[model samples]
Target: MNDPRSPAQDPDSGSGLADWTAGAADWIARADRIAAISRPATEILLARLDPQPGQRILDVASGAGDPAFSIAERVGSAGSVLATDGVAEMVTALEGRARERGLTNVQAQVVSAESLAFTPGRFDGASCRFGAMFFDDAARTFGAMATAVRSGGRLAALVWSCDDRNPYFTVVTAALDAVGADPVEVARTVFELDDPEEVLAACRGGGWVDARVEAVGFPWRLPDTRPETLIDTQSELSRKLRKRMEGLSADQIERARGIVAERVGQLEAAIQDGDDLIMPAECLALSGRAP
Candidate 1:
């Protein structure tokens, strides 16, 4: 649900983001909620990157430009970021956001990681958040990124850890299973690459060396959000449930909503901050250096 290719660099744009094309609206709508929940990981990502002024950075899978525009702010006017994704709709949303923020140094486009057009050693460093797990081929995806970065520049990101430690993902998912809908297949789950060894192998296969993996986790915060707002942002649940209830009545939607609310309430009752909720989560903060 993230990242973009540069519109100005249409020559490099590809159609690899079909998976997210129709989901663009959902991604944009959920961006803010996602940000609040993911801040814990993003904080660690930025710390490890320590992006410098005047550095050319690449923000891959920069959906709604999470750390991309945020990085653009840190790099200031001297540095720029090429935020890219395979979905044009997602890039369009990012473009709107950049304009709203008056970010002249940031650019969004429909670029695929499989077809990066930059020259070797083109960037000072790169960043990707949760986007790595969705790639069709993780190794080749990172390899392309490595080929584009300068030596000494590192790529850092936050990836979901195992499901057991990240209950925010599993709690709601388990609820759906209890409701008789099959959960997303484990192979297709976002935490598929939770294993550090798998990540290390991907880094090495991608021409990135000196890799490091660090634990970074936090609660799924409800900052400026609530159960209803949070519910709409649940991608896995919304998507699967929508298909499961395709021909049902409005009553069915309402019933499903009630079930989710009850399930979520029970899971968070112990940790609820009045109306605010905090769900436990686990993630890995990783870095890979260009050779």
Candidate 2:
């Protein structure tokens, strides 16, 4: 079973930074695949943020620069986006991607969400996608974001809804359990902020007013239905699961891998898709206004 601690108490918040730093290169390599899967949620967040031309936007925990780059395009040359991540490696990757795309309007920086050291009201809008749930101090981080935005500016965040509603996460947990490997630690942190009300309360506590939550669901479509592809992709994407597998013996690891393959095979048989597997994913999009 997973732990029942609140988001603030979970140690993964700190470890998650280290994990992301170590996996930065892998994430960069798979950035396009991830971006495609997360585009729907990004659209939801952008709609809530309501960014406009000639405006400055702040993207906190901007991993591989998905919405940041998207926002940069939306804002055009007249506006700018400051993409900040706590991990320097992530920032470096983001910079590389921005440069490759010739995005002069997007700037990457190594800034922690809890310690956003920008001038007061420096941004017209801010966003954080799939990053809020891993925050060590949600209220403090959100408050810092609020401080950086002007009055009435919007703040939008996207977080995972729950384990059951997210097949991408549950599949791995089920695989681990099937092989008798403990998945409690990984499961605990991934869904820490699954509750929408908790996100609303945190935003309100951080001085963001008129906070509301919306549910966003999308299909995480993969081009291949192969079990090996699923296992390899999930292993690369989930740092906690990868780290856990690293501690297991070769036989134990093989057992878990086999379980994942079996489960994925079953899914393939049930779905009967010719070349693709579409996993259902759900996220909570929270929007609020700065005080």
Q: Which candidate is the best by lDDT?
A: 2
lDDT of 2 by residue, 64-130 (tens): 8998999999888999999988767677778889999999999877866666667889999889998
In model 1, which runs have C-alpha deviations exceeding 4 angstroms? 1-16, 182-187, 223-237, 242-270
* RMSD after CA superposition, every candidate: 5.0, 6.3
Shift of residue 183 alpha carbon in model 2, Å: 5.2
Per-candidate TM-score against the hidden true structure: 0.82, 0.84
Model 1 lDDT per residue over 135-179, tens place:
777788788888889998988877788987776666555544555
Candidate 2 residue runs with Cα over 4 Å from true position: 1-15, 182-188, 226-229, 243-273
Under the 3 Å rule for N, CA and C atoms, how many clashes does model 1 have?
Answer: 12
Q: Deviation in angstroms for 189 in model 1?
A: 2.6
